[model samples]
Target: MYQKIIKESNENKIFQYLFKSKENFVINDIANALNMSFPTVKRVVDILVKKNIIVERDKIGEGVGRKARVYGFNPDFCYSIGIRITSHSFQFILINGYCEIKKEKLYNIELDTSSIVDSLEECINNFIATLNVDEKKHLIGVGIATRGIVNNEKNFVEFSNTDSFPLRSLESIRKKLGVPVLIENESNLAVISESILGLGQKLNHFVCLTLSDSISCSTFQKEQHDSFSFKAGRIHHMNINPDGNLCECGSKGCLGSYISDKALILEFKKFFPEINDFDEIFSEKYLETNFGKLLINNYIKHLAIGIRNLLFFSNPEKLIITGKICKYKNIIKPELLKAIYTPNHIFYRGEDTILFSKFNEQTGILGAAIFPIVDSLF
Candidate 1:
């Protein structure tokens, strides 16, 4: 059993290495990197190749000597479906093994679980019907990215402010879809996406801050055991201000209350009663006004406080900001940095430590889709 565990560990390492690099590697290169014997590496590689997970991509060297074959993961080996359920819409995406979106569909619907599950079934069926039989054979499973307290181990959503979707709803979706289903907190998935495909890719320690209807944070770090671990929803309820406004969670000055879209909208209404949507609030017409600047400044100040608290606690190498608020990153980033550098706080990191997410709206979905693929390999 010990020998088997070690062998599986090596295989997982090799798979993760290839998946991350996206480069074709020869047996010698993998063996050296993994600190394993060439024979053992070759044996594992052969198994992966036969399983259609990896393929011989190219050959190096001319006819003068035996050409070394380079291998890489086959991008079409398997596919995953990612579903993002929000307060007003459902986003479905079909992703290939390479984490590329093959197809996507969006539906604006009521925020009830029954409606969502019904819509999801239709979407999955329509998506599957579009693929060729051979391509369909590669379909592995589905992942649902949601907002709220998710019991990932049980594939259950314990609670959410958006709607009343119970744990059994996940099982219903799985039974109807006839595939393995995974349910995870959307913020957590966003962190996963950043870690795998965005700015956090190479970082050993980082934090992801998502500002949407509510504020959320996820932290990633390499543990003492040399294994990666993450904690989701750690910063939402953190008290950033003691005398600040009340939050939906019934707390005063919570991070979520200060930086969420709802908070911004409420603050905007105080200055510009006519503003409705985020676009209007962030528009040049509003931004040029004193009220707009004031609103933005206040928002940035509060956000900076929350961010400062995060940095003080985690001291992460990088902080990635995602969600709807990132659209105003150009205007907000500088102010946020300034707030952080004020005399009240002492932060040594440069401006480069902060970054906006690269994947935009698809970040959560892509992360959800990649979860099963990563789980299968590791």
Candidate 2:
């Protein structure tokens, strides 16, 4: 059984090693690192090279012996499409094997099951028309990130608050697009991106809090005993205040009610009726106002309360905060740290446990693009 597991994991181990390192490696080095025989490593490398997943780069001589050929991943060998669907817009990005965006387009359209499928077909067709024949041949699959519970097994959305978006399977979109489709919750996608490519790369256990149009959290833990674990989005509904504002989930005092984009906008409009967009509320001119300062203070307090609850429950090695709220890192981080570091809450650790997202807005889409590649490897 142990041997079977190792045999099954060999390809994934090799791919992960090559993906993590920036430099090329000879077959011998790969064998040594992976603790596999030289012939076995060479066989795997040869297969990958033939598949265009990796390529032989250059030869380097050691002493007076023959030079050894080094192999490296082929970043442009294939591409994937990543789509982020929200109530107000859809963001489409094309990423190469190296997980870099080659092209991106954003469309502001009201979302429903039928409209999303139609728009996706049109956008994909137009986008593919722009690519050359060689680039077109490299197209592999598509991954979508959205703001709700996704039944990955059925490729359907279970429920969502995006106005009038239907609860339906994605088979229609899959047939129209003619590619493998993967759908995941936006917050889960963000955490996956962080775990593989962002601040959580070195952490085996961490919590990600995303403050976007809504607020959500994802906790990642390396399996211990394999007992069933709670899913990530459940943390979004954690109760923070008993008599606080009512939430769309039909609950009062939920954390999301205090920190979501809609909540912040409502708070801002109460002070400045002239404010038209959420982006304007974050402007330096607006933030300088007394009302803006009050809003900031309230936001920080609630955000801190939510983070404190997460720390106590999960005890994660790190807590990463992302999304639109992070744009005000300068104002948010200080007050957040101050609130969390109080003597009574010191047991949850200090500022060292916290980190702001590195990828910012692109985190979810990039995660979507890499999903296929990572899934194939593992």
Candidate 3:
């Protein structure tokens, strides 16, 4: 029992070191950091390295004497392929071990059945052609981020309203692509990316609310294991109003029915039918126009109500607002704060802070890049 307990404790210590440190450590450094014997630490390192989770760095300096090699997560051992397929465009990126974009491509494509797989293949082939032979072999897997109900387990998408094709057959694309693939609902992927590297980094629990015309939420709960991995995506489609308009998802009074980008655009068009382009509808010069201010104010009101409904069950440390709606944060900060503070439950300290995504529009791409970097660490 004591031996097993000691082994578990050592494993925990190793995890703690990896979680907190920015730089890599050799066996001796780990031993010193953990205040354990060198041989014991070396045994732990050997186990982790054998798991292909951590990597031993090459020895430096020419020496006849014993060389103590540096060791850390391999920055070149794995790569994560991240693909973000949205209504307006599709983005694909190849991330290297260091969580950097080694190669990337973005283009708009028609969301159709025949075109979907072809587009994905073309994007992958084009991106792969740019890489030399050695880099091609290091690809660990591909991750697909798309809108609608995605089956994470089978890498199948159950449905997508963006197009009339069978996107649910993404597994076939994976087999053709010749790599393991992970299909994540886009909103959930967004939250995962944020939880790992964005505003949600420090918080263990939080809800990422996509404030675009397509409103959705992704929640993250850090699983308490030997490491820092977490469970993500418990989306609840709560109705914002019973008498509200119908949503694209075929629900009435859904939050998306009131505050989705389409809803906002429809609201604005009704007021200013002459404005067709987004730039004109939300132009800086147009803010002085009565219609512009009204649109902005109305948007904030609906947003506040939507947010209030989210906070009903969750007491997240922070509420991260992303997508196009974040553009209005500066314009509606005062009112947004007021709405969040209106409720005064005993548990609701009203300390819920709001922040914009630092990575902003590039969150999906960057997050895709991080998957490989994180895999290297694990």
Candidate 4:
């Protein structure tokens, strides 16, 4: 029993090291970095190669003691499906083990359009049917990203703002598909994706502030036994003022009343009243106007305050900002950072403790896909 435990521990360390690696390595490299003996690294590498999780990419060196084989993590060893659910649409992505999106599709949907649960199940099963032979063979599971609070214990959504979104536990779908099914908040999923595949890969703690069409935030804390937990997507509704503007949640002074999609649209329409592009909220034409100036100043102020609170409370190694707001990173991200910058503060002085996700649009589903991969392997 003792020997089996140690063997499994070694296998886990080696597999995770390879999965998180961006470059292929030789046996010496793995042994040195992981502080394992050369022989032990070779044994684990051979095991992973046999499982098809790692593959021989090339050989390195010559003329010395013979060429050394280079091993690469093979993402194509398995696959998963990620689904993002919204009141207006369902977004889907198929990803391999590496978490790179291989396929994407969007379907316009609404609660009033049909029985939300039935339609979604049918859609997912239909999507599965379209996979090729190898894809179906390697597919591991499905992950659903939703705004609702997921009750994984019961396999149903317990709370949702839409009130009519899919409330049925996806366990039935899991049975039909013959693979595991999981659900998580979209913001939590985004943070999970970052932990597994993005800047937070090596970090034990972090926070992700997600800005899709809506605003939400979640924190990541790696627990013992290789488990992960996230909480507080409702951070958007944290009241910043007691007497400020009304939020859609029927509360005044909520942070969402100031910076959420509806707030931005309501504020922008007061001036432009014309059709608006989300990017234009930061456009030169918009910001130069008096109303835009006030709007931006307020946005920067509250954004900084919210971020500062998150930093101090969570004390994460890094803070990841994900959303369409990043498209204006050139203007918004810098200014927000500057607002929070303090002369004596170490984190803000130059280190990239705060970071932006590369592609805001993709992380939700990508994160959704990675949840199951983490569940199965790690």
Provide the TM-score for each candidate, comma-separated: 0.86, 0.87, 0.75, 0.87
Per-residue lDDT value at 249 in model 1: 72
| Winner of 3 and 4 under TM-score | 4
Q: Rank the candidates by lDDT, best first.
A: 1, 4, 2, 3
Order the numbered candidates by TM-score, best leading. 4, 2, 1, 3
Of 2 and 4, the candidate ranking higher by lDDT: 4
| Cα lDDT, all candidates | 0.77, 0.75, 0.65, 0.76
Say which prediction, candidate 1 or candidate 4, comes out ahead on lDDT.
Answer: 1
Is 1 or 2 the stronger prediction by TM-score? 2
Indicate the worst ten consecutive residues by lDDT in candidate 4: 1-10
Residue pairs whose backbone atoms clash in candidate 2? none
TM-score of 3: 0.75
Decide which is better by TM-score, 1 or 3.
1
Summing lDDT over every window of 10 consecutive residues in candidate 1, give the lowest-scoring window. 1-10
Model 4 agreement with the true structure over 1-378: per-residue lDDT tens digits: 000111247788888777777478999998898899999989988999899989998788867778989889988899999998876788888988777788878878764424666777877977887788888999999988876566544545634454533445455788888988887888888887787788777777788888655577888876665556777467767888999888777888878677765577678888788837676677788888898888877787887777877787777788888877767777776678777776676553243777988867567788888878777776
RMSD of each: 3.8, 3.9, 5.9, 4.1
Candidate 4 lDDT score at position 157: 65
Q: Which has the higher lDDT value, candidate number 3 or candidate number 4?
A: 4
